[model samples]
Target: MSSSALPKPQMRDLLANCLRFHIVGAIIVSLEVAASYEFGVAEPRKKAYADSTKTMIPHKDFEERRKPGVFQSTK
Candidate 1:
């Protein structure tokens, strides 16, 4: 067996993959931000409108509670 051995090159591959992952992530985030701004799909006006118009539709449990009588499963 030789006293000297080649050093492991695993770190180089790991670093390259990490850099690539970050670059891809950055690109995806940038594109998403650009698309959001371009389309204005997430504007506050629409959100406010939705919030203002939001309402709760009562279900079977609510009706049963309101009557205050023997419980019956509507299922």
Candidate 2:
């Protein structure tokens, strides 16, 4: 029997296939995370409203009424 060498796979084809797989996987993972956040955290956080306890004030008035050194670094 004659000895024959099997064809070697091209680097470009291997790299392309790997890149395509990774891109598809990343897209799927990102979509899943976004869906989970929208359903789990985003919706719940909005409805839970730890902000409800705090009074809402006008932005300009709040800024103007701030006491000096209140926001300054203690150092």
Angstrom error at residue 42, model 2: 0.7
Q: Per-residue alpha-carbon lDDT of model 1 for 1-66, expressed as tens digits?
A: 999999877855798899999999999999999888856865767777778667644575578675
Per-residue accuracy of model 2 over 1-75 as CA lDDT, tens digit each: 659978886867888899999999999999999999999999888876757535555665556556554546432
For candidate 1, report its TM-score: 0.38
* Off by more than 4 A, model 2: 1-7, 50-75
Best by lDDT: 2
Off by over 4 Å in 1: 1-9, 41-75
lDDT, each prediction: 0.76, 0.77
TM-score of each: 0.38, 0.52
